[model samples]
Target: MILRMAWRNIWRNKLRSITIMMAVALGLTAGVFASAMINGMMQSRFHEFIENQISHLQLHHPDFVGQQEVYQHTGVPRDQLDRVLENPMVRAATVRTKVHSMIASATYTGGVELMGVLPENEKQTTGFHNNVVEGNYLEKHGTNEILLGSALAEKMRVQVGSRVVLTFQDVDHNMVSAAFLVTGLYETGYTRYDESFALVHMDYLNNQINIGNSFHEMALLLTDIDHIPAMTKELEVMFPGLHVRAWNEVSPEMSVLVEAGDVFAYIFLVIILLGLAFGLLNTMLMAVYERTREIGMMMAIGMNKQRIFALILFETLALSLVGGVFGIVGSWAIVSWVSRVGIDLSAFDDVMKEIGFSPVIYPVLETAFFITLILFVMLTALIASIYPSLRAMRLNPAESAKR
Candidate 1:
């Protein structure tokens, strides 16, 4: 009975009721779309770093990971790596010899972390070969070949086929200098990475450093990212002496950003809903004030205060649910269309690239998010109805009927 009365009473002031509903609808639509945009940007950056740089997990010499000393190698044997590769969860694995060195061209000299990698294995692990923007990926059998970042290439005033010298300390604390031919220029759209790293053949580097069959880092990509925790544990047991770390452990800041992004999104949504709640409160308050006489007459005719309160609560819920339905559907449609087309922020390409983000973003939202949002809207309606429902419940039958 209360539900029926609540629904009917809403239409008695159709224009006012619709005005509040549209306000709620529009507010929710804007809020949801904004959350989707934030989530898309964060997801893009996460994938970019994971797929193109760090892989899912990495194994490193404990000393090497801490100090990055050229002499601190993993010292794992070939058979150990073979066992790791045999794991079904590991999609690809590659060893890398990394060292800090000075790279010089005719026009410039700068510091870079030189990564010596096996061409084929590295390609499977990091897919960096696809980032080659000019020239070609290092030949599988290529010797003394180097891949430079496009930004570094430009800074060095060097081009493909240019000669560059790398000077670094080798094992036994000896400084060694070697020349490499720039075979390719790659751009990963991460300014810091582009400017800070270069690539060469792992065999050649091991020969220079005199670390026969030893590498500093072993990076692994998993068949499924969800298996990271289990795989990390397996690898830890497999190489008890080495430090095994998941992508989150390797990049704690990015992990923090991911968690913080979710919190920020929810906070932003709460703020939007809080604003709409005020509008809802005011609208319901006006409705209750105008219905005082009607409410009193109902009480005189045997409608209890509990029923009166329920009627107001039900009316507020009806308004919220009607608006919420429209809002969710409209946001879903817009999000779907825009996600397919993408939102282009090309105008801020340089800034985006500098921060390691893609200029184009595809919005995404999980179905769970919509479900939670609906519950939040209902909660907001319940809170907003409290004062109005209490006011209606407190009306004196004789006094209100006289007015």
Candidate 2:
């Protein structure tokens, strides 16, 4: 009976009911769309970091992380790494010998970390070859070939085929200098990583340091990202003396951005709901005020205060549901369309790229958020209806009927 009455009451005042309903729907639309776009942006950023910079897991001599010396490298070679790749979970792994050094051209010298990498293995692990803008990736046994980040190349004022001399310490802590031809230039879109690092054939550095097959780092890329924790655990057990870490462990700030992004998305949802609540509260309160006499008549006829209160609350809920449905439908349409084409913020490209971010973002929301939205709107209606429901319940039957 209450449901039937609530339905009839809302339509009797279609314009007013619809206005509040639209408000609710629009509020939810804004909230949902905002969440999806931000979610997409963060997800993109996370993947970019994993693919370009960190891969999935890194292994090194336990002291290598602390000492950061060329001598602290691992003695394991490519074959040792391939043995682990036999595991189904391990997709690809690459060895790198890192040395902190100054890369100098005739005109400029910049402090950089020289990363010695096996071309094929590094290509499989990092996909760095795909990112090359000029020239080609390092060739196997291509004597003194160097792949440089475009920003790093630019900073040193050199381009492809330019010879750059790298000076760094040998295994014995004695300084060794070598000249490498710029075989490739890569732009990772991550300016910091690009400007601070350079790549060369692992054998070149190993030969220079006189340590055959010695490496400072081993990076493992997985078949699936979800395998990170399990793989990290397995690798830790497999290589006891080596330091094994997942990308998140290596870069906590990126981890924090990913984890905290959801929190911020929900906070935005709440703020939108709260703003919509005020409009709902006013509409419900007015409905209660105008129906005072009718409510009293219902009470006088035989309805109890509980039923009367419920009827008023039900009407408000019905109104909110109408808005919530429209909002969900509209948001779904917009998100679906926008997700494919993406919202291009190319206008803000300069600002965005400056901070190592992409301007184009595709908004994406989880399925759970839609369910949560309906519940949130219902909750808002429940809270908004409280004062109005109480007011109806307080109406004096005889006096209200007379009024």
Candidate 3:
């Protein structure tokens, strides 16, 4: 009976009721879309940056990461690589030899991190072929050719077919120098990597260091990202002589950024709910004022005070339910559109790449976000009605009727 009365009473003030519903709906919609978009952009950037640039997993000698001075100290043997790659979860693997070196071309010179990679295997693991911008990826077993990042090429004032000399310390602590012909140039859209790293055929690097069948690091790709922790544990158990780290473990800064985005989303959600709470509070207070005479008449006719309170509470709950349902449905429609079309960041490509992020992102909406949003809006509406409902119950029939 109270629900029927509350429902009929809401129709008596259709304009005000609709205005409050619109405010609640808009608030909820903004909250849902904002959270989804930010989270989606962060996740997309993280996956591309980590998977394409940094492999899912890395194997190093116990002290290799700390003292990456030479390619030989933390070198993993070629024979051991085959055993590690036997795991079903391992999709691909590559061996790398890295050293800090000074590169010179004609009149220009700059310092770079020289990476020695196997031409054939590196592509299978790192998407190195797709990142090539100007020329082809390195050729197998080639000694005189090298690939330069676009920024590095510009720094050294060199292009394809230019000769450059690279100087670095060998495994024996002796200075090693080699001349390489620039066969290709690549732009990864990541400034830190493109400007700082150079790739060379592993054969030349091994010969310079006088080391055979050894590498500074072994990078691996997994078929599924969820299997990273389990596979890392397995690798550790299988090869207790080596150190293993997942991409998230290797890149703590990126992980923190992803987590921080989530925290911010939650904070914004609370702020939106608070605003909706105030809106609901105002509406419930107005409804109490407008219906005072009607409520007093019911009390004068011997209606119980508790029954009057229940009627007010029921009306508030009905309004909340209607508004909450519409808000959730409307948000779903907006999120679906944005997720499909995506928000473009092409104009900010240079800025994003400078900070080690991908330029384009697609939004992802999760079920938990939707469910939590609905519950929060409904709870806020209920809480907002408490004071208004109590005030109506405390009114004296004589005083209210006189007014």
The 0-to-1 C-alpha lDDT of every candidate, in the order given, reads 0.91, 0.86, 0.82
> Model 1, stretches more than 4 Å misplaced?
140-142
lDDT of 3 by residue, 263-375 (tens): 98888788988988887788888888988888888999998889888888877777777877787898888878878887778899889788766666666778887887777
Cα distance off (Å), candidate 3, residue 81: 2.4
Error of 1 at 288 (Å): 0.9
Output the better candidate (1/3) by TM-score: 1
Number of the top candidate by TM-score?
1
lDDT of 1: 0.91
Off by over 4 Å in 2: 140-142
lDDT of 1 by residue, 1-403 (tens): 7789899989999999999899889999999999999898899899889888999999999988779999899888544667888999999998889999999988898899999998988898889999999999989563899999999999999999899999999988899999999999999988889999999998899889888888999999999999998998998888888898899899999999889878877887998899878988999899988988888999999999999999999999999999999999999999989999999999998899899999999988999999999999999999999999999999999999988
Error of 1 at 60 (Å): 0.7
Candidate 2, residue 57: Cα displacement in angstroms equals 1.4
Residue pairs in collision within model 1: none
Error of 2 at 226 (Å): 3.1
lDDT string for model 2 (1-403, tens) is 8999989998888899888888888988998998897799899888888876788899988888877987787776657887778889988888888889998999888799998888888778878898899998887584899989888888889999899999988999899999999989997777777888899888888888877777888888889999988998888787787899888888899999998889888988989888877887888788878887888899999999999889988998998898899999999999999999998888987576666677888888878889988898899889988988998899899999997
Clashes of 1: 0
Better of 2 and 3 by TM-score: 2
